[model samples]
Target: MNEKLTKEEIMAALNERHSPEKQALLSEGRVAIAGLGGLGSNVAYALARIGVGHLHLIDFDVVDITNLNRQQYFMEHLGMYKTDALKSLLLKINPYLDIQTDCVKVTEENIVDLLGDEPIICEAFDRPEAKAMLVNGVLEHFPEKKLVSATGMAGYGSSNTIRTKRLMKNFYLCGDGVTEPEYGNGLMAPRVAICAAHEANMITRLILGEEEI
Candidate 1:
């Protein structure tokens, strides 16, 4: 006799596709996104829909009028912490998502605490120095974990240039790496989102134990 799939069954089957292992690593995949701006916002939202269960959000900035251009923040979220605002939107998409917010500036001191047990980390810091600081600290602290950071997703040109490159073992870098607008650069929404998507995809693949995809 043939049996029908229930809601839980249907979702479980779909979840299995993300990671065949029990308690799907992807579904239980804990991740820490270190920025909550243009790239980070969309990345977090995309990961939530893709079945990422736990997320640790770290951001120290509030919504600004200038951020409305390409950032995910909307007019209604003005004056709100980016992490708080993103958490609200992410919860709306998937209430089951474990969204933990950290409205602190990541530094050498609090990085260890800010980052829980997430196996993968995404860097969305726009400022080069800030990004490097986090990257160095994480690498020094946890050499085994995977870290993906964006480099040069500025200016409005070809979307094709936005790509990902593996810098080393358990480390990947995404973005144009240059070709940004000269002084006072502007970033396009599509390009930023594309890069973030690649980073999220890499994180998913790593969690799945996929072979060097």
Candidate 2:
């Protein structure tokens, strides 16, 4: 016979790993992720593993075979919408999670509506234009909210180069900031996940009341 852990049992294990106080704070954390590519997918995985109670996953793209190199999706998730696939994966990690999924592209017009409810927004688009759209849109429309973004995480550069920097009172940037895929080898898992960890850690720090990075 197969057995499944109850939600309470799962939560108890999470709290034991995260500590009761830290898990309590994490459980109250809310974030909206824009673009479920490498960075966003890894960030969502890290946060969900740490017991972030609520997450709003926004992505218009479907999982592609190319995404297997760096994204969290598996072979079984190919062709599935990123939001749906990621939500399903996250639920497997933390079944008690509260998740919201949006399958529409995050255009300037809809960005505010998609992310307004969440206190922190993560920009994880692959293209520069799309990244700018989310960052600019969130900063312009929701100045009071926090935005975490990434740049130059592509290629097999030194993992140490991946870092988090405070860009403004409400914005943070992660990654080497110099190794664009066009110039470097291309997006690899280690560097991408390293950058994503910076973003995820920064978001967690913010959630835990440590804003400075």
Give the top-scoring candidate (TM-score).
2
Off by over 4 Å in 2: none
Q: Per-residue lDDT tens digits of candidate 2, residues 67-186?
A: 999999999999999999999999888778999999999998888789889999989889999998888888899999989999988888788888889989999999888888864499
Cα error of candidate 2 at position 49, Å: 0.5
lDDT of each: 0.81, 0.91
> What does the lDDT read for residue 75 in candidate 2?
99
Model 2 lDDT at residue 184: 49
Task: Tell me each candidate's TM-score.
Answer: 0.88, 0.96
Clashing pairs in 2: none
Maximum-lDDT candidate: 2
The local lDDT score (0 to 100) that residue 204 gets in candidate 2 is: 95
lDDT of 2 at 5: 71
RMSD of candidate 1 to true structure, Å: 4.5
- Model 2: worst 10 consecutive residues (lDDT sum): 1-10
Q: Looking at candidate 2, what is the lDDT of residue 39?
A: 92
Per-residue lDDT for 47 in model 2? 95
